[model samples]
Target: MPELPEVETFKQYFESTSLNKQIKNIKIKDTRILSIEENIFINTLRGKKFNSVTRHGKYLFVECNSFFLVMHFGMTGDLEYYRRGEEEPKYSKVLFEFTNNHILSYISTRMFGKLDITDDYKKYINKNRLGPDALTMSYEEFLMSLKRRTTNVKTALMNQRIICGIGNIYSDEILFRTQINPLTKINILQEYQLKELFTNIKEILKYGIRKKGNLATYSSKLIIPHRIEEENCPICHTPIKRYEILGRHGFFCPTCQKEN
Candidate 1:
């Protein structure tokens, strides 16, 4: 799934390529990837210009002067900007044709991406109940969000209601850096550890954003790069382990991130 960093990259890309371009047409190849009716979606963007692209958690909202086009890149969603004569992506479900002879294709291999139009994004956020974005949440705000969580710390961190913009991949990185086990209960940790956890959440996620979420290209101690090789932990030389949570895979070094 595309997390905060990946989605932020997408937002930046959308801003650079699609902004200020007049929407000449909106084409929908699949009905499953749209949240609104096809006609409404088409009419909303017709003759409009993209002003900005904003990201919250895993969602991207393209701000037109009159409305926002919501984009939720569900597991394998991506955007491709190419000339109109070029072949659209194989999985292009939605294509935005511009008067400039370019097209922005919305691609989702798994048919899970969503497109919708909203005049008020705050109402959309509230309706979905997403917590504050991880990048901007203050320390106090982080603690307050976690106050209601009784589950394991890993699960708490992954909870969208507590702190949006974290998923299985980043959750494992945050916990591993903090040396906290995925199964460690929230109340079992020390106050100092809790503070550290919040700190690492921001630090690690910021690192991801800086890297543009390309885990494989970089050489780091992060478990993500090693997951493909099934290698030993760089810090402790212990074998990295994988666990399934809610049908998602999380990787960690067992010796380093032992349960508290």
Candidate 2:
């Protein structure tokens, strides 16, 4: 799945390449990915100018002349930018051809991503009941977001309604960085601990972006998950431990990150 850093990278890439361009055509390979009717989606986008591309959490927001387009990359979804007459890759699922001959493709190995059209983004957000974005959230605000939750630390971090943009992979990485146990209860986090968590969250996110958001897997470089199963710890040189938390694989260094 594409997390916040990856989504932000796509947002930046689209903004730089496809912004302010008029849509010449749109090709929807799979109708199931459309939240609205296919004809309506094509009608709403054709000939309209793309004002900007923004991302809130994992949702990509494409601002057109009349409405916003929300994109959720459920799993194995990615974006590709190409120019005219170039062979569209085999994985290019949806193609948005621009007047300037630039082609923006939404490619997914699995068809889980969705595209939705809405005039009022606030209404859509409220309908979805998403919480504040993790990248923009403040330390105090993050604590407040978790104050009411009685779930385990892992569950709280993975809850999009509690704090957006964090998924299973990043949550595990964040806990490792903060030395917080993944099984810790949300309500038990102290003030100083909350501060530490907040700090580590931002730090790890920034680091991931700088590393091109490939903390999971990417075709390029293929180096990710600094602490995978049986891998050596980057921090303490101890053997990294792998366990199950929230039904997902969690990796950490027992010597470096002590559970309290």
Candidate 3:
């Protein structure tokens, strides 16, 4: 799934490659992922332009005045741009053609992603109860949210209702960096440790966006690379261990992140 960093990268990519041009046509090659009636969707966006775009948590909003197009990139959603006469990308669910003949494709291998339009994004957000974005949330707010949760630290951080944007993968990275065991109860954390956790959450998520959401570009100490290589810890050379948290798998250095 595309997390906050990946979605942020996609937002920048969209602005640079597909912004400002008037949309000439809307094509939905796959009806499986449609959130609205095809005709309604086509009628709403075919002639209008995407005035601006923004991201909240893992969702992307393409705005045109009060109307907003919300994209939930489930599992494998992505964006691609190309000119006419070139081969269209494989697995492209929808295509947005501009008046200049350029195209933006919304591709998903699995049909999990959905594109829906709304007049008030605020209502939509509140209805779904998505918390403040991980990147923009204040440290005080984050601390307060976590302090209220009695769940394990990993579950607390990954809960979107508490603080959005972090999913399974980034939660592991944050806890590992903070040296907090995944199973650590939230109430057991000291004030200093909570502060450290908050700092690492912001720093790590920003670092991920800076690297364009490419795990290969991450620091050697990050567990992503270690998992990919099936190797020992980059910092301590301890064998990285994987344990199940809820339904997700978490990776940590046994020596570094002992149970609290």
In order of TM-score, best first, we have 1, 3, 2
Per-residue lDDT of 1-260 in model 1, one digit per residue for the tens? Answer: 48888888888889889999999998899988988888989988999899988888888888987699999988898989999889888999999999999999999999878989999888899898999889888888888887757898878878888788998888888888899999888877889999899899898888888888777654577776776437889799888887777777778888999877
Residue 230 displacement (Å), model 1: 4.4
- Taking all chains together, each candidate's TM-score versus the true structure is 0.96, 0.91, 0.95
Worst 10 residues of 2 by lDDT: 216-225
**Which of the two candidates, 2 or 3, achieves a greater lDDT against the reference?**
3
Across residues 1-260, which tens digit of lDDT does each residue of candidate 3 receive? 48899999999989898777888999999987888898888888887788888888898889875688888888899999999889999999999999998999999989989999888887878888888889998987787677667899888888888888998888888988898888889988998998899899998899999998987778887877776335798778988888888887788888889887
Q: What is the lDDT of residue 76 in candidate 1?
A: 91
lDDT by residue (62-97, candidate 2, tens digit) is 889769988888877888888888888676667999
Those runs of model 3 whose alpha carbons end farther than 4 Å from true positions after fitting are 228-230
Q: What lDDT does candidate 3 reach at residue 165?
A: 92
Q: What local lDDT does model 1 show for residue 107?
A: 93
Q: Give the lDDT ranking, best first.
A: 3, 1, 2
Off by over 4 Å in 1: 228-230
